[model samples]
Structure formats: structure tokens, C-alpha cells
Target chain A: MSFPYSEKVMEYFSHPKNVGEIEDADAVATEGSPACGDMVKLYLKINPETKSIEDIKFKSYGCASNIATASIITELSKNKTIEEAKKLTWKKASETLGGLPPAKVHCAVLAVDALRTAIENYEHKMGLLKEKKSTDTNIIEKRLKRVINPLTGLEVLKVNFVKKIDLDDGIITITVNLDSDHPFANNIREEIVERLEPLWDIKKVYVIFNDENERH
Target chain B: MEKRNVYLDNNATTRTDERVVEHMNHYHLNDYAVASSQFSHTPGIKAKDGIEKARQIIAEKISALNNEIVFTSGSAESNNLALKGIALANRAAKRNRIVVSKIEHFSVLDSAKRLGKEGYDIAFVDVDGEGFIDIDHLKNLVNDETLLVSIIHGNHEIGTVQDLHSISEIVHKKGAYFHTDATYSFLQIPVDVKKYGIDLMTVSSDKIHGPKGVGALYVSEDVIIEKITDGGFQEFNLRGGTENVSGIAGFGKACEIFSEEDVERIKYLRNDLYEQFKSGLKGVQLNGSSDFSRRIPNNLNLSFDYIEGESVVLHLDMRGISVITGSACFSRALQASHILLAMGFSHERAHGSIRFSPSKYTLKEDIDYTVHHVKEVVTKLRKLSPLVEQQ
Candidate 1:
């Protein structure tokens, strides 16, 4: 059966691009999955002044796509700046190789993660976090906030540690902010009551804290 | 952009064959009525006809009577039914011990374990380094309380063939039932149900070029089988629910093809490939029985010692040569292969094991290419190993 891969990717893998090692590599990264008997090692050299990749090579230890993905990543990364290299994703690599089936798609993602992680290691050594940033955190925060506290039926605005009642037992009761005047506050109180039902045996836990303890 | 996929995971699950697909499609399209429907019964009648045809063909292949075969989803279901069904059905008599081999598939092993939870005593028969079961040990393990003797016809990991005839005789002498999960080596070998005296046997379609999610259980006419699934009386009130007509028909077609011409032809190709591999490769050790008669024709399990099976398989996959690793990587599934471990191989050797199973469609050139790549890849991967250096 014909597998999804570009002529270039297939050719490079058949006669793998940079088949062996770089004796004195600028950066070398190895990722291993002991379960699947898959291991991948990447070697790269970057012109630190320009931050553009010079030489990129890899040795892959998994499936056909693993080699193709690793080889493609190296070829694609060569001549690209470190900042540009980190932006490389599995979707783009797979798209570059035509495409991978749903199951083998994980192989491409693994290759990309290995490449970016290798680049990150190099950057950490050089003490450089790329100035480029993503807006994902904003969207993620919004999505995570949707998970309301089932106990108090409230949006957990913040969590502050109340003083421990007993050191040996690791027990503490903290105050949670629920809108007292809200119409559903009675329902929220009932919800808290229901939540604490199983935990009721430890009866000392009450929701009250000093105003000074609410500092961020 | 044009892309082609070469799937090598046939042992895991095969691509449904063209003829089987056609048969199934016909049943699903033209014969869409439920087999149980009282009103609008043409489709129902066709479905029943298709099922009966499947059952008859399956029965003939295994040398079983038509009434002896019960349809199931797959080997897992069939195995569970054979083990648990027999146990539960005979529970009233309070016969509650199961004797099985360690080299049996996870389906059989897990089912046995589940039965243990239900207060059944379970004893395991172990295999040697060559994956052969100790028949004497199996004989010693059987006692009066033993309810069933479950052994696999073949080992899935190391391609080990068990002496089913000997096992059957021993179990029968003890007055306990013998069941074999024949899914691994049934179609590959001549499965003489009478010769082995198998009280219960399970066979799956996908393993032998049929559809997945379809299999059959061979119950001897004399062996009283109790129902497992409690519902409608579809499969003679033994296994309940509406029939998968398409799957059953496809399974029947696969069984027919298996019993006819595919057997000798596939075996020839498999032997040729093995001969080429044995001659071409050095430092390669076959894990199971080296004798062709003692093993499955198409399955070649080997421990490359220095090179990891995952590395070899992955390299082959990249080259569009599909193969399977007998061991699981740490980050992969939890089951790394209990069969290989049970066969006295070290953890390192187990992880270095690979299984090469050729189908009826596997051509000579494909095997040659595989051999060539096996030589090259094993050489390359061994260089990355300290074990090779030490050796």
C-alpha cells in the first residue's frame, strides 16, 4: 500500500538526509520512549550571531514517519533562525510531507516536539527566551474559568491558604467568596451543604476568614 | 498531493478483504432488515441465510458441526464466553478451577483473572525459552476441581506452537474440559477440532483476512454451553443480540478462502521468506520453534539481541515496510508482552523481539525487500548499542 509522503521526504528517508552524526554538534538532543522502543536523537548547529540554523541532523529509532518527520524537521530547520525554528509544528511538517493518517499523525507531532525542545535547550544554554509570544494563555484562562466550584457553586476567583488547624493532621478550612446577595446564594449555600455532606464528619470546617487574609 | 499507506499491523487488525467487504456491503445495503423482525421479513430472511452460510463454512473449516458454532464479536468475547460461560454454566456443580498456559493471549489470561475474582482457582502452565508449553506440568496441574483447561493453539508474541493433542488428552483424562484460543494459529495450521478433542475453540475473522469485530466459538455438541449475554435469543439463545450479518458473511467467506487455496500458497511464500531471512542475516536468532511444522507458516519472531524491536519496526515502517514489535515501549501500552517474558526471555531480549507475519497477499519481492532492510537496519541500530560493543 502507498503511504502518504512527498517524493523529497521519501527520498531523504530512503537515503536518509545526513545519515550519520556530526562529530562536534552545536546542540544534541535525544528523546526516548522506552515503551514503544522508539528513540530519537537530533544534532544541530546555529550561527549564534544571526541565530539561523547551520547544520541539522538526526537519528530516529521508531516507525517510518518518525524518520521522515525527523529528517524533514532537520531539512526545514537548516538556514532558519532559532526563533523561526521553534514555530515549526507537526501540522506544518505533515502538510509539507503531503499528510499523515490520523494514527501516524502523533509521529509527526512527536518529531516537532523533539525539534522545538532541542532548540529550547540550546536557547536555555545561551540564556535567550524568544521575544515572540502567543495569545493562548488568555483563551485558556477563559476556558478554565468555566469549571465552577461544585461545592459553593461559585467562580473561584482566588485561593488563599488559611492557617492550619493542626500541623500533624494537615487539615485547614479556607473561606470562599460567593456573592451573598445573589438570588441563587441560598442555592449556593445548599450546594455547599451538599458538598460538605460526605466531609461532614470533620465538622470544624467553616467558611470564615479575616479581611487581611484575602491579600493576593 | 498523492500519498499511499502501507499497513504492516495485520496481526493487530487486517484491512477487510475485497470479497469479504463486498459480501458485507451487500448484506448491509440490500439486506438491511433485522434477523429478529416479524414484520417486513425479506431482509430478515436474507440476514438469516447469510448467517447460516457463514456458520456452515466456519464449521467445515474447523471440522465442527453447524450447531456447534456460536457467533461472537472477536476472540476476546469468544475466549471470555468459553472460559466464563463454561465456568458459570457449570457453577452449580461447584467445579471452579481453570488450568491455562502463561503463553495464552491477554484475552484468555485476563478472562482467567476475572474468573479468579469470582472465586475460581486459576493455575498457569509456563513455556520454555522456545515458547513450547510443558505438557507434563499441565498434566500435574489438573485435579478434580479443575473446571476447564484453556491453552492457546499458538503463542502470539514468539510464534510458539503448543501440542494441542497432548494437552487435550491430559485435560480429558482429568474429566475437565479443554478450550484453545485458536485465533493466532488456527487458519495458518490445519485445525482438526476432532484430532485435538477441543471441547471449546475460538476463532476470529480479522486474523485470517476477514472483518474485525466478528468471530466464532466451536462448542462440541456433547459439551453443554450456558448463555453468557442475557437478552434476545439470536445465536440459539447462547449469545444474545441481533446478528452482524455483514461481518458474519465476510467471516464465512474468509473461512472458505482459508480452507481452499490460500493455505498452501501463503505457507510457501512464508517458508521462502524465512529461508531468505535465515540465510541472509547473521547474529539473528529465531525465538520460537525453528522447525516449519512446529510453528505458524507466516509468523517469524526473532530477538535481534542488540537492536531494539521498536527501532527496527519503526525503521521498517518509515520505509513502507510494515512489521510489529513483540515488546511494548515504556511510554506505550502497559502490556509489553507477558508471553515473551513467560517464555524465559529477559526483559531486554523481550523488548528486542519483532514479529514478521506475511499475509496471503505478501509477495516474494516484498519479503526480499524486507530481508534487505532487516540486514541494513539491524546493522545501523546495533551500532547505537553498548550491548553490541560488549558482545
Candidate 2:
């Protein structure tokens, strides 16, 4: 079978750079999870004086695209200042790897999410950022933004699948515009729940699909 | 000669045997007339003879009557025809309930699903951890209302060979027709329809080193089934289309050339490869039945801890090895093997599972090379895996 991976993707997958842990890393963060089919952990050694990333490494438990995307994300962010690294979007990492298949675009998103989380962790460690309340809607929205609609290679929120998000009594109810019988509804629902269920305050996560007639 | 590519994905499709190809060439070039024109001309009679000879060869392999065989495109079409045909034909009998094992191939499972959409009651029986059909669960599912039960004879992914005699007994006790997709275990495992009490069976050519685009469905003479496709009076008027004469001839030749010795050798190679992996690698677990007698000889599925399967498959591909994985990332649907999941394996186990099926053409040297490279690849990938603990 023909794999849709680009030449650059195959190159990075074959010989990924910075593939290990920084034992004395200033910050470390993991995004995605084993249950989600892909997980990436990023380690950052930040230069305290310059606020720049001194070294970066990654370890991945995922497919070729996942490894390749993480490799490129590290390559794009190394030695850059924290503010500059924050601007390193998943699209840029994907472009540097010649672009990923639509189904694999989430791997790029996951890599960028891990890198940004590491940066945020470093900033938090340095007392530069305040600890936001865990139950904030902003946190919910940000997590949902990483929940990709596999069919469109876009976030559920951006695709307008999230018709409504209700948080009450520690239970989060997400209403998606997709029909219950839609081919990808179950997958999207599972991903949404996986994204939200791990919250520090979430007691239960419920994903409701809008009726097919009301989908439009 | 130095070996270049090592192919261990024989369960998917084998390299068409050279002898089978030569046998097919004679029918394609010399006896090119339509088999349906047997009543009108000499070439037509020759074509008809070729078709009948092939039917006899395939039928004899399974110990079924020559007239019971209906040729189709492949296992998928055979399965579709068997499930839909039996269900539709038996509608008047008020037997609207159809049962199938959870681990059946997509063709059978999806056809049952379509039947479900059409208002037929479909029940999926579960399988055990080693991929054996849950006999007790199957007994509970089949009853007077059940029309047919379709289960896979040899699982394609994990290599579990079901006890056909026992499964058939259970289905028949409840007056349901038994059908099995025997694509993987056709000649490698002995199947006697009469002895096993099977009413229908699906067999494919490509899996047995025959030409692609050819397979046969074995229907018992007493079993009534309707044609799903509308066409001319072909395939006992149960399936309609111009016959694939050359492909059928090749399929027959492939069956005729089946050797028990080759199966034994392939089994040995498969076991040897597994033994090498067991000794050479760490964190390796066999996915299917440990007993060789209970599994297809050529198939070996192993799950490596801490690393995902697609990464291992891709790395092997680079080293001229061909294999397949049960990982969601490897499939178009982005779903892990339902069979593995149904067997109660964790998603991690399914994602890490890789299947290696050696054919008669596989050599000991190739297995050695594969094991050597697999060790290196798994070691490298393990190092890069976050799941693996840092030393």
C-alpha cells in the first residue's frame, strides 16, 4: 500500500534528531495520550538569562507522522526565544516537512501542543505566568481546539461541530453539530471526551450529537 | 543469489505461482470462447470443459460437489453473496435473525450490518482471548429464528483457526445454515463440508498463490439462496456475470498444486521466526493461540511493548521486509483491528501488534535477516518511545 507521507517526512522518521530526554530539562510536557493512538513528550532546556530555548528533545509513542512532526517541531523551535517559539505553529512544522496527509495533520498539532505546553511549563516555573483556575471555560476551549475532526484535519471548534459547550456542576456537556449516525461522530466524540475528561475538575464528560435534521 | 526483499505478508496475498500462471495462459489464449456457448460451438465446449474442470478441482479440495461451487470475484464477493443471498432467499421462512462471529472479515460483518439496516436482526457472537469463537455465547445466540451463521475459519490478522466441526454443530442444532470464510485456511487446513456439516464456505485464489480476481463459494445443494446481482444465467443462476475463465483455471491449478509438505515447511519457518524473535527481542508477546495446531501455520502475530506497530512496519519496509500491523495509524479507517479489540486486548496491545505470515517461497535466511533487522528497529524505536523508561 502507498503511504501518503512526503519525502521529508520519511527522512525525519528514518533519522529523527534530538530523540531522547534532557535529564536536567528546565521544563517538560506531554500532549495526546497512549489511548488516543499517539503521544508526544517534549523536553526543553531553556537559557534562564536570555529566555531562549537552549536545547530540545522529544520522545514519541506514535506513528511515522507523529515522530516526523515532533522531529520537525523541535528543529523549528530550537535556540529560538520563548516568545518566538510560541509563534512556531503546527502549520509551519508541517510545511517544513513538505506537508502531512489530512489524516496525519493532527500529529503536527500534537507536536506543537507538546512544545507549547513545555514552554508554558517553563514560564510557569520561572514565575512569569499566573496559575489560572482549572475549571475556566478558556481551559476547556483551549483543550477542545486540540481535538481535531479527523475528516477535515481541523479542530472541532473551528469546524463549527461544537454547537454548544456547557459546564455545570463539574460535568461538561458538549453538543456537536454532527449527526449521531455520521461516520466520524463516534470518533470525534471519543476524542472530545479524551481531551476534556482529564481535567482536574471534570466529574463527567458527555458529548451529544445534534439530530441529523438539525445538523445544518 | 542474494535475497533482496523478504515478504511475510502472504496472508494478505501470495505471489502468484508461475505454474498457475502458465496453466491460466492456455485457457486465456486457446480456449477463449464463452463457456455459455457450449451448446453452439466446439471452442465453447472446450471453454465449458475448462470451467467445469476448475469447479471440480476446487470442489474436490473441500470435498464438496462440483455443482455446489459458485465462482465470484474473490473472498469479499463470496462472503457478500453468501450472507445476503441466504438472508434474502430465506426471508419467507420467517428466519430473519442472522448470526456472525465478532471477528469475521469486513465483507461478512458489513453485509450483516447492511442486512441489519434492512430490518434483519443481526447478532454478533464474541471470541475468546486466543480468537476462538465463544461456543457458549454462540449457542445462546443461535435459535429457531436464526437463518444463517457466518464465522471466519482462519482469522486473517491473528491466525486463529476455529473449530469448524464444533461451530457447525452449534449452528445446525438451532437449524441455522453455517458459512465460513476459509480464505486463509483453504488448502492449508483440511475442510470436509459433509463431515463438518457446513452449508456454505468462501475460498479465495490470491491467498493460495493463484491469480487474483477469482474465488468460489460452496453452497450445499439443499440450501436455498438467491442471487444478489442481476444478470445472465451463470453460476447455477445464483450469481450472474461472464465467468473469469483464465482466473478460474489458474485457481483450479493452484488448488491442484497444493502440497501438504509446503504447508509443513511454511509452518516450520513461521515457528522458527517466532522462536528467533522470542530469544532476540525483549518485551515481545504472542497475540494468538500458543498451540500451533489451533492456528494457521504460516501466521504469527506479535505485539512489542513500548513501541507502536506502524513504526516497526515502516522500518522493516525500508529494510526490504513486508509485513502488516493492527495499529489504527496503519489503516484507512484509523481504527485498531476490531478482532484484536473484540478479543479484549487493550488499545495499546492492538497498536503494537504486527502480523508475520511466511509463504512457501520464504527462506530461512530471509527469516534470519528479518529477525536481525527487527531487533535493530525495535531497539531504535524503543529508545525514541516515551513509553519506555529511561535507563
Model 1 CA lDDT for position A125: 51
Shift of residue B156 alpha carbon in model 1, Å: 2.3
Off by over 4 Å in 1: A1-216, B1-8, B37-40
Candidate 2 local lDDT, residue B358: 95
Instruction: List model 2 lDDT by residue over B1-391, tens digit each.
Output: 3446999999999999999999899988898888865567888888888889999999998899999999999999999999999988877888889999999999999999999998899999999999998989999999999999999999999999999999998898888899999999999999999999999999999999999999999999989899998888899998888888999989999999989999999999999999999998989999988888989988999999878888999999988999999998999999888998899887778888999999999999998889888999999999998777667
For each candidate in turn, the interface RMSD (Å) is 15.7, 7.0
Which pairs clash in the backbone of model 2?
Answer: none
In model 1, what is the error at residue B11, expressed in angstroms?
2.8
lDDT on C-alpha atoms for all candidate structures: 0.70, 0.87
lDDT of 1: 0.70
lDDT of 2 at B138: 92
What C-alpha lDDT does candidate 2 achieve relative to the native structure? 0.87
- What tens-digit string does per-residue lDDT give for candidate 1 at B288-341? 887768887667787775556755775677667887776554224534567777
TM-scores of the candidates are: 0.66, 0.87
Taking the candidates in order, what DockQ does each have?
0.09, 0.30
